[model samples]
Target: MQQQPGLLFTLASFVAMIAVLVVVHEGGHYLAGRLFNTRIEAFGVGFGRELFGWTDKRCVRWRVNAIPLGGYVKFVGDMNEVSQIDPAIMALPERERRGLFAFLPLWQRAIIVAAGPLINFVFAILILAGFNLALGHPSSPPVVDKVVEGSAAAAAGLQPGDRILSVNGTSIARFEDIVTEVVTGVGKPVTLDIVRAGVPREVTVVPKMVETVDRFGNVTRHPQLGIVRPAEVIEDVGVADAFRLAVVDTGSIIATIGRTLRQVILGERSLAEMGGPVKTAQIAGQQASLGLVSAIAFMAFFSINLGFINLLPIPTLDGGHLLLYGIEAVRRQPLAEKVQQWAFMSGFAALMSLMAVLTWHDFGSVGLWARLSGLLG
Candidate 1:
């Protein structure tokens, strides 16, 4: 079935957003290839027939296409879009195939493949750093405000207006840190160094396990001390502080995502929590509606996710290629052609299945399915 022309606006927005990230990702491969002295035949910003483009002086076809969904970099002596090796490489003269990607050493190929995801992470960090500097990253100090009556905090002799100095000797920088400390120490006693009325004292409290549901109906269990964030006061820091906080923030995000993936793998979390491209597009559209800052924040978030996803050691991804290269390095030869072929097919199928499920899930999320059912009725 043909897609309606009315969806072009949404498609255009999605394409434009994805194109920027894809450029950053594919450009990493291009630069890495150049650094490794590999010959490039074509560098496409999108797949399929060329919409319009120009060949560089080095004879590389740098082009964009009608389909702005994704991009690729084709190297000399490659059979298809990805840098998968071609059988014809064997027929080439030694010196000729030497500059080809496949003929490059295993370590070099691994670097080239891994570069794309690595650069995406760097891009995400830079974007987050920019946001921190511009928005004045709210550094809310961990000052106790409202303590739930008869709760663990109250039972521990904690009172309102007490400033939490540290948790388990890890100095508290922000109110958010308190949550981190308490949640991690769930069901276990935690020492808090508090400053109250110009006098310092130590208090020990145990966080109670509590289950909460998010907007998506996902339930998460955390240790709660029944304390709320003090108040809204944005602490402006220096350039050094901005980058330091940015790195911390980015690392925290990566850790959280890693934990979530682990939970899914362990069957502790629902698979419905995982989202695909359509889900991403829906969220992106919502964020874009808020304003440019929101959109940029969303981009930074997706950039981090994109980097992490590509770095997974599943087939057809950068990590998968790196894994193959690692095997090749150990064995001193490439895997059999049949094995590589099977792996690629499996990876492709897995990727497509994930996309299909996510797209179906997204329709329900955006109310598109309800609207369609209404029309049918």
Candidate 2:
């Protein structure tokens, strides 16, 4: 049995992941701003009280703060880390405003804001590409080696020696493809084209939702089809092929995320599956305990998620800024200050509420509430 990661280890892993991703994200914004000669007032890691910092030659204050949850980059003429405009900076002479972020051309500003998320995607792709180059590509044939008794696969008449050809009309190149389809189509009927004994046939299987408890007392639920695959095959690939595969993999993962979000919104998936900071830390810790390669892979996956999340068109996020810029581009004018402020406020509130709910769920998943109640009794 694998040893569970300790609390401290898990927390350290989580913090490290956040720190690296935050720097990469904010670094993208900072680099793009510099490319356009936009002045940066501060680049901070973490939030709240300052732990230590230094002023760069360009007068950018680089800071390490007390709270390690998140970080920010404050552009010139911004009132806060979220980059709200400072009216006082607007009053500065036009000459003084030349390098201010607010004064930059709309296109330049948009690029600066978008750089953060774009770089995250790039970062993930590079990581995956590197892995592929070093480890080669891994795949297993979509042949069923065994079918668990009383499982959905058994109910659907799937048997050993069956080869899956497609899932809902999507061609399955490998066993992983079948697993992905089943996982994503949890609790829904999945149509599979299969070949058995040199004969083609089809089956409809409804994956059952299953709950699991890890050694650390964390509960997780996911859908599963009780079919096992044979040994995997590893194929060597050139650098070009590796990179191409990485791009394809990254795009597929992004699309999967979009699909999952859509399912959640459409009530096809459970909100409880969504994880917050606590759950993320737990997962980070588990990955770290597995080994360096596992940890790095998790980091890459999280990087893609981070980038995708920021691109959401919620106010106060990078996507929100881009949305406003898009509107300004269409209207040839910025929205009213009041309107922008209200939107940001609403976004902030919505985010906080979501965080609260997810955190609660995370705590419950770990039996924290149960423990507390037991202690009280």
Return the TM-score for candidate 2, rounded to 2 decimals.
0.94
Model-by-model lDDT, in order?
Answer: 0.80, 0.91
Worst ten in a row by lDDT for model 2: 212-221
Name the lDDT of candidate 1. Answer: 0.80
The C-alpha TM-scores of every prediction are 0.81, 0.94
| Residue lDDT tens for model 1, 1-377 | 22222355456556777999999999999999999888999988888889899998899999898777778889988778866778867888776767888777778888899899888888888887787777778767799888998788988989989999998898888888777666644367889999999999999998787888644343557678888777777767668878888889887678667867886777766566677777677566656655678778888888888889889887788888888888988999989988987898898898889789877877776578999999999
Clashing pairs in 1: none
RMSD of 2: 1.9
